[model samples]
Target chain A: MPYLIWALMRDCMPRRWWFGFFAGLLLATVLSFDTNLGAHSLGSYLAYVSVFPLVLLFRCGWVLQQRTSQGWPHQEKLRDSRGYKAPLVEFFGLSTLLLIIYVCASIPCWWNPYPSPPASAGYYPVTIHFGANDYWLFDLHSPVPASSTLLLTLDWSQVQNPEQDVWIQDPNGRKLQAIPGELLRWPLSPAEAKEGKMALHSLPKVGVELRRPLTRLEIPRPGMQQGPHLLLLQFLFFWPLFAMLLAWHRRGKLSGTLSAWTCFALGSLAAMPMQATDLDSGPLALLARAVLLLKLALPPVEGLLAAGARMERLAFTSAATSISGWLVLGALSLWLACKEKRPVQP
Target chain B: MSTATALILDNLVLHRGGKRLLGPLSLNLAAGQKGYLAGGNGAGKTTLMETICGFLPTVEGRIQTATPLGYVPQEPLFPLHLHCQDYLTQLFHLGCNRSMNCTQAVQEALHRFQLAAYGKHPIARLSRGWRQRLNLAQAWLGNPQLLLLDEPQTALDPEGMDCLQAAIQQTTAAVLIVAPEKSGCSKLAPLLGTLSVEAPCLI
Candidate 1:
């Protein structure tokens, strides 16, 4: 397999593709320097997003165009000698290499070598303010573990009635009556509390301390967890579609039905409203549903971004979807390959 | 299917898009034999050759080959972005010549086809005649027992025609070429016979 990949890289990948690879690498590296442009940023999104399509288009499109314009006797020759497996290996091997290169190029965006400020064992001052909804929200710069026992020391010197005026609310917005205590002990549990805005009834100088020393957790960026899966899905989604389209083109069935379907599918994907609620009724909604199912089956970049900070679900769904999509597309491409064994009558 | 016969087509019928096109044809070419398939426009000559190479499924009868086959299609499409030598090298790797050195085999093919000077040149940069030679060179790789060339004389000059004839004559493979009227078939020495596609019978 490595030998085949090496052969394909040396022979199949054109000079322009190499140049594009290097250019994309440079662009990705340059974009990574801007900390503001992280995984979800458009630059990083385009960097990983464009590689699959570009590789697919150049490799498959070139083969299809050449087969259309001039006969592809090499395929026949290879088939005669070694059956059809060689070309299939060549196509997939080269595509995998390109995707690997894309991952390498986008590495800088996901990896940050510099260590952030260490979280020490001390009480950190927290600011408590009333939000627009009249609910008090606490702002903490550091991420607190869900299971930590937090000590919230409130200075009730300004409050006339310390018990009635000042109260702490749990994550669910239910108020917990504050007894006349120097420190309010709140035991955070994964089931009952989350790491988000915690409401307080009174405006006071608040300080929070965990049972253990605050340690900086090395949370992986969203792309680091989901990037490879996204690329794999991209390959699964596009490679077989291109093969099916090329098969249709070769069979002279592309211009009317398949082409229209392709255009409609693409148009529906492009016209998908930013907010999911925008798709409510009519043909657009139906198309949106179809597109949504397609996206679920093969999650696109938007799906990756929508996954956001919660990567576990994304990882699970991505694995399931990638496998399912790979199987379906694999079967479909195999069917097309079998159907295309005989030359179409002109 | 004899040990000495390279290819045998026994009453082979072909179809395209579910419509009957060519055949109920039969022919036998022994190893090292050379022949031409002649026909007018739209006679399914290329289709017949493609079917023989297993590119197209045969509708009826048996098409058997005793040895590995090589095919050169009419208006062959190459990786135009690849250099001539690189393309040949790829073919060598893809071919059944794993025992041989790829560079040496490719170099030999280039020299044989008189494409040695254009080794570094991109296939797209080559002239029509040179491209045709490159196509022939690729087909000759792996030293297959049978070689099928479709309109091998399409873009060849007189000198290119001579080069092709020499290569075909020197090769041990059974050479079956699709030749139009007044093609380089006349120049191909030790010609076995001509198979007319219009009649679907060997003459």
Candidate 2:
């Protein structure tokens, strides 16, 4: 194994690999900085985490293609040396090292001088005060269902009057009146009352029927929201896909490396139709369903990325389908490696 | 499968695209013995070499080897980005010479092939003759028991040809050279026994 790794580093670590590595680092840093400056939400963080590794993996795949085309691991001197096992081990070893480097690059992004806030259930607190005859008309960052509920937390000590009704105005300027329920006030100590402290659970939940899709929301909160740490899972999902593509390229089915890249680009574009919110029974809906099935057949990396960017969890069925898709791709790659019999020509 | 034999072919027939190409011939080479295979154009000399190297599947019969083999195709390709020495070092690590020092093996190969001066040069910049010398260097790097050379004399100058002849004379491995004409085999005639690849009969 040590010799295999040394050989791979000697032969496979071309200048292009180093260029890609530094480029990926720069890209990840920029994306992380952008997320820190922009929404600072879970979706933005997840987007950064998902995208940077993808760029690196694409470059790695290109390097693999170039070396494989030049007859790496299957060169004349290396024939009959433990079959595909050596090459596979070498590739995975280098790829894992790349992932580790990526993680180290991400450590600076995770460093925040101030501690992060408590995890809210995907809710950003609106800082505007609710007063009688004064309406806060703001749009949501994303669309929500008509039956979605809004939570209102108010400190009684800071409230001018606690008996007014709060209404949520939809995009069409129609107001859905909020009926004030029983006062669910928390018993606060003297020090807490002096500090205007209030528990979030004691807040009132108001049912707001959004008549139309809200386009934007103006939340001026300062703290960054923590997203699910999905680096490990993203590595698991994408490494296999990259390996499968490498294996497929090595199989010589597609004419050349350019064709392999084109196929990957087309597959990525096919994942775009999955972002359509309304999939009615039109031709677009048909295309979307076909793409979804294709994603189910392939790695589904872009589908998962889209879902992560939208801060939406995949439906149980979709997640299951994607898992099975990953399994199939992984199995196919292993089968290709094992069934490979022809010597690679120089 | 005698211990002294380096390679054996018994009734070995080869096919390409369901058409019989080369076949039904058998030969054997003992350890340290040099052999030559001669054929005209469209004959199966290269095909047979590829088959023996496991690049092509045999349509009938078997090919057995007593030890690890090294092969040099008629037209070998190199990774253009690698330095000549680095390429040889990688090949040394990949070959069955793991017990030896890699740098020493690579340096020796460069010295033997007169590539010592070109060790730091990228393979892309090398001329055809130099590339052929590099190919020969890699084939003889790990000192495999069986060496398969397919038209290795193609791009060599007379000096390179002399170096090849001297290297072949000094090596203890069993060498099989595929030559397209008698002139290419003339210098090594005393050390090698020649075999001809016959044209396949039309069905």
Candidate 3:
């Protein structure tokens, strides 16, 4: 891919001027994404935003190195050289084998026949009804003892007064009022709270009242924590694919189409099982299985997934500044690639 | 008329930068013949050679050739990393290499140019003599039926000139060169006809 990109821009992007062009692009990306990123962890966002241009920079470095070492190479008139070729069947067979191994690594057959979902295991969803009472209490004793986050989803249409306040009281008798987004989220980190009861209060003193008939409540155990060894093993499941892609990219073989499609597949697999999205299941669920494989295979640890999510939105969204920048770069590259060359003087 | 002619240029007028460069010139070369071209600097000597090699288009004339053409520019440019032998091989490949085995052809070219000792050296590090020899060596590969050289002897030493002259004698192809001095390669001088061109701006 780097070779292709270099070939495309060779005439227009002379070696002497490419560094400045790259610096300008880097500065543009940084400034464009600055407003969307919080200053508290600016480094994380910068790293995320820098990935694409950094990849481009790596390619540019490779191009420069090759040029300095080799000078004007044989213009790869790929249109002419049809002598060396690979059969498509053989390539497809190899790709399929890798994909099968990926699937096997995703399923927890040898580890656990019945694996639980993470969102349900450590968290609870619930609804509460009040009988002209100041507060309603619910007991949750089946939950395994551990710390987790508590979340509340209330039906907005059922509230008679917009000023009404709804709050949750843990077994420690500590209460937290609902914040904005109408979805209350409080940390239920106490070990006792995992096996104890909690209450929902309708505080009329805060001019808050709930005129609802029924509330749906769901409490789950927080005992599904994955061991570090298991997590590492799952992460290494796609080792073969990772190795194959690295080998291909390093070697710089394979046709342009083959290289591009292979990278696309590899990138997509690496990005699946998004940290913030719920895993879906249904018919034709092999897609989900693939995502599950990557989920366990390339687990985003240390909040990397959240950072990636932010980067994805900024780089891919129509409103994002980087999208226009990339489009401009891509168009310029194409124009350079196709432009007619004026014959060189003898 | 010759039984076999390598090239034919009839009343050819060449132009560069929308200005007449050379001729109302006319020339013909029989198969396996050899000659030299002459002109002052900026006199369109290089331009005329390039035009004959089909590197540049003639403003008003026709060029008819019986065999494929090969060109060696005055200042030969090649990839700095290309090995001497690899450069020959690539030349062979470019010629569609129907005549002989690629390795054998490259070896023959290297031996002809006396470059076998420096086969492994990077072209950038090669001296001017070797670079010029390599340039001519590529033109000689796959035995171009007609070879056009533009001021090829400018940087070459006496031994280099002797080697090129000897190679020209050995080849069964029409060889034309642009030379400013009529000296050197004494044995081959009688056969070296001159194609004189004038400066394009003067015209």
Candidate 4:
């Protein structure tokens, strides 16, 4: 993907500038350690961004230097003598393959058949009753076991309306609320709580009060802790698809279209699987499973259930939509690909 | 058959490395005329060509050509990845504002230069003669009203030079051939109508 990006931008940059750019990026990457990448790890992030431009700069500069002194006739001879065009089959086939791989990689495979090992597991149970303006907790328990670490995983759901807010009070009057789009992960060490390393007042008086009945909750457990790893893998798998796209961007209309479509399809596929594969299956699990079930049964069932002409029409329309999407992407890429040539004298 | 002169250079003075190349020079190249500028090695032939091509900064002068002039520099500086046909296409696309059948135009240009066989060829593999032809082809691809050639006679063999000279004479556009040495002048004599660097400067 970076190669594609570099190739696309090679003409826009001058030969002399890219070397130092890439070198500086490499230097920064070398200086940074992966473990040290906290929120403050700007160096590591910049280093990653630097790789593409640097590669592009070096490649373009090398080509420029190798050909500069050859003179006009030499260049013309080079252009005129050896006739070459990327074969149509190679172009389209490679694009199609990359697209498929990209799509497959992108498909979010959220389901894990094997049980995950327990890192730290416990659930927080709470009962609550409704108040005038909000809900008040009736009971709360800190599932703390001695010599073991406790991860507080709260399940928030709207049983009645499915759109209500849920709030919990720590030991202190301070409240921990579950917003519409948020994750809750709290670690409690029994040793610290026993030694009074942290003030009891700091721990909110545990109480669960839902604005409505519990309809859904993201309960964190030993199995569900694998979110980060799964997310990373999902991200990496989609990387190559994006890379192929960036590399082939400047090749021409066809390749550009294929790369873009591949990126889109792969992106959608990867996202779906990643989203579906949670150890903690939320209320949306059924919806995700239904989609997966259709995908699994698509090959044979599609032919048997749907009429041949109907299926053909559906497939043709889907393909047409994808092709059109690629065409638009190609047009945009081409517009951006044609670098404004520097004034010859300058 | 005088159309308003296509190119006019007046009091054109150019200095290279503290030496005067073209000094207070003046000339008028009328439309459709084949003209040449002859001088010694450092006598400002290339400097004059560069100046006319708007590539060099003139010390003191006024020069004008058709709005879209075609210049074939001594050396062709282009990207390596571009093929000959693609290059011609790019030139045709950039040079013209109107929508025309550029493919046919390109085919004709290739045939005219005897480069039809090398139409889809990559520029990196051609020999010197063919490459020169490609250079000329790019300049002629636009079919601009004004054409500028710099030391065009240097790399060509006798037969190749003859073909070039004939092409130059056949061009309908006004042309300025810069040939500084006696060999260059003698070689290009058949194509040009008059040779002068001491003519009245057209202000």
Which predicted model would earn the best DockQ? 2
Each prediction's RMSD to truth: 9.0, 9.4, 16.2, 17.9
Q: Is candidate 1 or candidate 3 better by lDDT?
A: 1
lDDT of 3 at B184: 50
Show the lowest summed lDDT stretch of 10 residues, model 2 chain A: A214-223
Tens-place lDDT per residue, model 4, B81-147, is: 6678866775564344355578887887776677788978887788787887777777677566777
**What TM value does model 4 have?**
0.46
Colliding pairs, model 3:
A126-A217, A127-A215, A127-A216, A164-A208, A165-A208
lDDT at position B55, candidate 1 = 68
Ranking by DockQ: 2, 1, 3, 4
> For model 2, what is the C-alpha lDDT against the true structure?
0.58
Error of 4 at A223 (Å): 14
TM-score of chain A of 1: 0.48
RMSD versus native structure for model 3: 16.2
Q: lDDT tens digits, residues B1-203, model 1? A: 67788888889877778987766788888888888766667777788887887666767888887456677878678777778986676566555355877778888888888999999999889998899899888887777788998888888898888888889889998888876656657567445444444556643
True-contact fraction in model 3 equals 0.06
> Each model's TM-score?
0.64, 0.70, 0.47, 0.46
lDDT score at residue B72, model 2, on the 0-100 scale = 79
Please give the clash total of every predicted structure, in order: 0, 2, 5, 39
Per-residue lDDT for A24 in model 3? Answer: 50
Off by over 4 Å in 4: A1-346, B1-3, B18-20, B77-83, B184-203
Residues A236-265, model 3: lDDT tens digits: 322233233323432444433344456446
